[model samples]
Target: MGKIIISTNVSLDGVVQDPDGQEGFRLGGWFGQFGGKDLEAWAKISLEEAMGTEALLLGRRSDEWFAERWQSRSGEWADRLNSLPKYVVSSNLEQPRWSNSTPLTGDVVNEVSKLKQELDGDIVVYASYQLGRTLIEHDLVDELRLVVFPVVLGAGERLFGETSDKKPLRLVHARTIGDGLAFLTYQPVRDA
Candidate 1:
């Protein structure tokens, strides 16, 4: 069975939106605001991890957002991501602009569970805040990889919301990047 990993970039206060200045949130652009070798190192590490991914699981909005940007890029990361199989969880989006994409139009939990059984490699969920929350709520997320930056936006989209139940997570790995960024890997504790 394949594991579903929820990987995200979060602020000090846990906000995950517009860190790259893409969204209209003028308060963002927090990442790389202060230039340093750490930021470059973190980027290299993230890109390396992304390249190892075999498939992508995304929400409709995130799918559209990334498809518009990463699909057009000619870098190694873009090439790998665009070539990998993509499963999008969406009720409204009938088709994705990127190639090798399939819509998860059925029950989210059931569909993902089936996919986990069928796939032979890792399934990564990137930047799908709401979808990540849903996967967490449904106990579908097997692991979480959080890249935390050292800045507070005070307000924006957060990784955890009200509906997120308290679940035990064990820290498996930790790394501090050069730019005051911390990469934390966590795995949910299975019930005994």
Candidate 2:
């Protein structure tokens, strides 16, 4: 069975919005605000994750967002992302803009559960907060790979959203990347 992993960069305050500043959020572009060795280290880690990801799961807006920015780019990371199987969760998305993309229009939980059984490796979710929340609530997310930057964006969309009940997590890994970034990995604690 495949593992569903929620992988994304976040701020110290848990803000995951407008990391690239393209969304015009006041705190946008936080992802590129830092520099030097720390930035390089973060990039390296992200690249490694992308290279190893078996597939990409995204929401409709996220799919559009990523395609707009990455479709024209060419490099190792870009190539890997572009070629990976992308599953976009949407009820009304007529066509996916990214390459090798498919739209999942049925129940999110059922579709994702099916994906988990079909694939054999990591099905990484990137910057799809709404979908992430649903997967998490359904207990479908196996791991969370979060690279936490040093800044605290006081106001922005957070990595987590409302759920019917609290989802407990177990920290599986934690480490710093260079001087300013922290990589934290967590897994949901399944009830015995």
Q: Which lDDT tens digits does candidate 1 get at residues 1-192?
A: 889999888887888888778788977787767324677787787788778788999999888888888877988877888898999998777897677999999888999999999987779998899988888888889999998888878888898876645778999999887748888999988782
- Among these predictions, the greatest lDDT belongs to 2
**Per-model lDDT:** 0.85, 0.91
Candidate 1 C-alpha error for residue 164, in Å: 6.2
Candidate 2 structure lDDT:
0.91
Q: Candidate 2 on 1-192: residue-level lDDT in tens?
A: 899999988999889999888888988998888534688887788899999999999999999999999999999999999999999999898799888999999999999999999999999999998898889888999999998988888999888888888899999999999988889999999983
How does candidate 2 fare on TM-score? 0.95
Question: What local lDDT score does residue 83 receive in model 1, on the 0 to 100 scale?
Answer: 94
| RMSD of model 2 against the true structure | 1.2
Model 1, runs deviating above 4 Å: 34-36
The per-prediction tally of clashing pairs is 2, 1
